[model samples]
Target: MEHRVSLITVGARDVETLAAFYEALGWTRVDSPDGVIAFDLLGQSLGIYPLAALADEIGVPESDLGHGAMALSHNVREKADVAPLLDRAQAAGGRLLKPAQDVFWGGHHGYFADPEGHIWEVAWNPFSALGPRGEFQWNGVG
Candidate 1:
């Protein structure tokens, strides 16, 4: 399998609400077929779908799908940009889970949870500066 991810889908209890939350975050929606709301990121697309439908398709109960154990990260180009972006998230209906602070790994970061409770980490990693188009690499862009 390729090492890159092409898409990330979130099963939401209310698709419209979750979609709106993302849209409020200044993400423009990409044209997708019915039942899925999609936003095209730098290298991948994020899709939001109905949680119950997702569970049914996977042949599992909705309760079996967990929401809190993982986090999606958004990396910034500078340390100073972290807190403001986190503030923007809060203004857009997301709950601030952690105020921005310097981490032991030498990064400045914070966390926020979307309306559906999906955790997101906003960070500025000096070791992994983003590309010109904002694509992220583990050890800085070549």
Candidate 2:
């Protein structure tokens, strides 16, 4: 019951394709044990596994592996990076969900969906401070 997440695994319709997409974004991936692909993030690991495999491991039918209303995000160091990040996502076979724009909170952000329809928000929040390696911290500022 620690307040830390060790890993996050998503059901990818095509693990190979998803892995390729991430590699295209310059992410280095480590081969997974079976039916999965793993990428080491800052403080966690992102795992991509086949939907059917994940469902079977959970004793659920593949049909139950449905998409949910949520977004995974990556915060950037500068506002200028938002657009290029979105563009990179698109080039990597992702779809642009929202064009980069200035936000009321004084940030720049955009949204994109991976080939499996998992939404990701790329943002540059001026008020919040990121760690040395681009880890986000809620600065409690406007």
What is candidate 2's lDDT per residue for 13-128, written digit by digit as tens?
Answer: 88899999989888998996686789899889899999988999999999988988889989998899999999999999999999999999789999999999999999998888
State which candidate has the highest lDDT. 1
Model 1 Cα lDDT, one tens digit per residue, 64-95 = 99785999999999999999999999998899
Alpha-carbon lDDT, every model = 0.91, 0.89
Model 2, poorest ten-residue lDDT window? 133-142
Q: Candidate 2: where are CA atoms >4 Å away?
A: 140-142
TM-score result, candidate 2: 0.94
Candidate 1: C-alpha lDDT: 0.91
